[model samples]
Target: MRILLIEDDPRLNEALCCALRQEGYEVDACLNGQEGLYYMETGTADLVLLDRMLPGLSGEELLQTRRKAGDTTPVLMLTAMGTLADRVTGLDLGADDYLVKPFAMEELMARIRSLSRRGGGFHVDSGELAWGDLTLAELSCQLRGPGGECTLSRRECGLLCALLRHPRQTLGRSQLLLSVWGPDTEVEDGNLDNYIFFLRKRLKSLNSRAAIQTVRGVGYRLTMQSEDSL
Candidate 1:
């Protein structure tokens, strides 16, 4: 999943970004609240790690603005304020969860997993996503169909999951890139093509009727073959 981290301390911000990246998550980090607000407005991040204290705009203000605007993206407030009133205020301001400063990375990761599974736009109970006859085990990166099943690499699973989530709608290349690789990642355009090719092969191996159709000079969309084509 992609995460947006808004923290003012350069050291803490850098450390958190590195740790999140090492854990295989796409992370976009900013040192202040204004920039953080811009990143959140882009709607690229699946989860947010927001610091309560920030310059220009406070985390509480940012969260309040996002929530007021009806953005339901899950946010985990990271702050040094550990008092009960502080925790209640943050939660009341619309944070999905709160984490105080000097936290263990293990605990942070656990919270991220919980929030991602809870609000990452997938089927929470089943841990699976489906479109047409194709079913994807999100946790295992396994793709299953009427014909067969195959394990997908994490990247491939992410690419396919994005498509399955919005079947039949053309998604721009840039959008797909931001979805799979964070906005900060320096990935080549060809890398996306390679993953698309890999996903196509995975679908074919399962003999599924689904297809990832390219939209000439635009992007790609997922479609299912008609019975006559089968």
Candidate 2:
């Protein structure tokens, strides 16, 4: 699963990132809320660990913005304020769960598993992502189709998930880059093109009707191949 950690405490952020990575999850960590907001808005992360107190934009504001904009990615609020009103407020602002600071790592992991199974605001059932005849199993890092199934690299899985999340819509190049490679990473445009090429090949090999169509100067869209064609 892909997770975004938004926390200002440098030590905590590093520790959380390391722990999540060790647990076999792809993680992106940021020290400020602005960067966190940008990542969340990209609609890539399966889950978000948001610190209630942050630099630039507070976690509350970030959650509020995402909720207002119809972004349903699950958010778990982390803060030192362990009070009744605080927890209620966080949930009211669209937080799926709240963890008080100095929390047990075991509990955090448990919550993550629970939220992942429940899915984000998009209401993904279990941990499977599906489009057309293909299913991307999030935990196994495998793509399954009518022709067969194959394991996917981490980057390939990320790119595929981003596209599957928006099926028919045309995703712009920059948006795909930000969602898959992240905003801070410097990657060539050709890199994305290469992945798209490989993904198309995979679909063809599976004999699936789904195809990734290039939108000329725009980007790409996932659509079903017409049975009459070829």
Which candidate achieves the best TM-score against the true structure? 1
Residues 77-141 of candidate 1: C-alpha lDDT, one tens digit per residue:
99899999999999999999998866755457657778877755832456678888899987788
- Residue pairs in collision within model 2: 72-121
- By lDDT, the best candidate is 1
> Candidates' lDDT values, in order?
0.84, 0.82
Number of backbone collisions per candidate: 0, 1
TM agreement with the true structure for every prediction: 0.57, 0.54
Query: RMSD in angstroms, candidate 1?
Result: 9.8
On the 0 to 100 scale, the lDDT of residue 114 in model 2 is 77
Candidate 2: worst 10 consecutive residues by lDDT?
119-128
lDDT of 1 at 21: 71
Minimum summed lDDT over a 10-residue window in model 1 is located at 118-127
